[model samples]
Target: MTWETGGKSEEPDGAGRRDPAPPPVGGILWSVAGDIRVLLTLPSALTMQVAHPAVGAGVDTYSVFRTDPWGRGERSLRSAQLWVYGGEEAAEEGRRLRRLHRTIQGTDTRGRPYHALMPANYAWVHATGFPVFRHASAYLQRRPYTPAEERQLYAEWLRVGRILGIHDRDMPQTLEEFWPYYRRMLAEELELTAVADELTSVDRPVPPPDRGPLALRLPLRLLWPVLFPPIARFRRFATIGLMPPDAREAIGLPWTDAQERRLRALGRVVRVVVPLLPERLRYLPLARRARARARRPG
Candidate 1:
């Protein structure tokens, strides 16, 4: 395949100082990243992200994943939506993320020093999403994206990477370059860090989701004992089941043939049902609003 700059900005920056442009309205990422269907596969993407030692270390040290898992996931999902659908807000969100991570440095379990902003670590986190979406689309999407669409999608993801402060040098610029890079990372860099283990472990201790109005919280707290087991089991299932098989093996995640069959069955239902929902229900609130604005006669 010929190398194509899918992520290159169409507009020239004369001063070479302008912030990277956000994914365009009606672009591949604008549609894919903002859809509610993405939630089905995001756990797997996140699990793959933390499989990198530096990222896992940073998350273990600084993230509230354990204590505030719901809030943490919600914020992450919202930030991702902004990157594709928040228009001008997308570039600001990216800068804000850099500022947030500026102070997040620590030593990994292996005693290697790591910083959250390290290009390789940050890029690896961004990179994991592409493959997960590609792989999981077979199950979650009504139809898997065609080869041309895949190229377009990867290119859009790279553009989003720039928004997150990742330079082109740190990420592959084309689909042809990306596959080799992705395989190399899987073969050489990724492993099951402690955070990855817990994320995919059924027995891991996860507190009841503790945010929301008191009225909502009280019932959820009371029902948590009954509600949490299925929720935890499903999280573990989705995280492992939706992961690319190569990455799953690289990270040493266990998966049975039976589980694969079940995951596929679930995906089929999601593909058929999710697309049938109306826009307000099918898309996240941020995406719903932005898509409406994009369609307005300007």
Candidate 2:
């Protein structure tokens, strides 16, 4: 995607001009992330990432991925998305992220050397994003991605990886090559880790439902405890269903007959309800802004 910004010199500190609508990581990347329920895919993505021995070891040692799991996940993902479409803000945050990971190299549980910045490790992290986008897009729309769109989506996401410093040589060049490589990694590289199990457990409280009018708040406060466990259970079940059976087994999240039944019913419910939302209401604010910016006349 050729960027054609006007001859520009106004960027602060001569940071230079960046395309507000960079094609590689725009559109589908923001659209997919904009889905409110995309949060469901987090445990699954994180589980897949940390299953790599080096990723697991690095995260366990230098990251707050466990102690402040939700906060850490939110900040890290926000940065990644910002890097894709937030222009200079993305660049600044990306640098901070690179600086943070600079010291995150050491040995894994097996005493093998590892570095978070290694192309291989960063690619492992980037690889997980594709499936998260795929599943969320599929579930929200009750539609599958066309082959062309899938490849396009992968291509776009690759630019995002590059922004975060993942090396091109370490990434699959096309969607055709990705699944096979992903499967091979699962067979050879993914392993169960205690942190992965803890993430999948999903026994924690979700964000509060309402923080507005006292009328709404009072009832939500009363009902939240009663409602949270079943909601969390369903989310856990849906996340487990997203992964292949072997991967689930590797992470020690057992799928049961009851979970399968509930998950299917939940999927049906989501398909029916989500599309009924007004298009404006269906996506996140960032997605709306990105879409609006993309459509503006050059």
Candidate 3:
């Protein structure tokens, strides 16, 4: 059987009916995922995906990440927000990604067959969210997560994992279970493929997001290209700081005394400053739209 969404069709199981998509992450998930500060951890999360050999191979073969870095990153981030907060839109995005990935299976450079749909690759992507929730909460709140909040946040990400086609049985159930798996993957599975290094090094400038107002937009457009290189440089250091020591070492990204100092200072500035803006300015407008949609899910 087949399902239609976003003008694309997907094959389902022999039964015409489909498993219902999980509810959107709310309560704890929204509180954590909604903050723009969560973006601070994005570089770390992204590098983790490509560190897996299959993920690296699939990205190089299938994605336009290098040639159009900003567009690729923006599209992926929008898809993620849709998956997390788009309600039925989230479900459709799930099927959409699943369909796109179905054709991406092939052999890697060393003669290993790799499919993007496999549990391990998806699981690794899901696992990156653990640190995102951990640090976002800590950074925004100026404190560590209590054990209960960590467990709840981990559980919420597992639902997100399901939406992304990861099976529940293949995922860790708690924060405690997550760390060991994360460490093991960092130690044994991650590698700095050429594509990944190029990705981490960042070949192009990142453009600013679409903020309303010609006034704001005009100045940002003129200024952003000028500031982007320094911002990109800071992103590299920030990525290193967020990563586990083993992962950064394996990936061959440098973390120097100067970078460490800059990263800490950067964190202090963003953590202290971003949340003080009026609530409307504090997060993405797309998140607000998605959140409203999630609440009214059919």
On TM-score, the leading prediction is 1
lDDT of 2 by residue, 1-298 (tens): 0000111232232145452333343456666666656666666777788888888887777666545544555565566557555755655554455556666788877778987778777788778878766765555446788888888889887777666656578898888788898888888788887556655666754554543467787777788888778877766776677665667766567888877676667767877887688867876566567667877999
Q: Give model 2's TM-score versus the native structure.
A: 0.78
Tens-digit lDDT track of model 3 for 161-206: 7777677788887767778988888787788876667656745445
Quote the positional error of residue 44 for candidate 3 in Å. 1.3
Q: Among these predicted structures, which one has the highest lDDT?
A: 1
Model 3, position 94: C-alpha lDDT score: 75
Error of 1 at 132 (Å): 0.8
User: After best superposition, candidate 1 residue 223: deviation in angstroms?
Assistant: 1.1
Model 1: per-residue lDDT, tens digit, 1-298? 0001111233322235577788777787787777888888888988898888878888887887777767677778778888888777878777667766776788976788988878888889889889998888888886788999999889888888988879999999999899999999999878999988988988887777666687888888888889988988998988898889999999999999999999989988998898899999999999999999998997
Return the candidate ranking by TM-score, descending: 1, 3, 2
Q: Of the pair 2 and 3, which is ahead by TM-score? A: 3
Each model's TM-score? 0.91, 0.78, 0.81
Off by over 4 Å in 2: 1-26, 202-228, 296-298
Model 1 C-alpha lDDT versus the unseen true structure: 0.82
Model 1: per-residue Cα lDDT at residue 110: 74
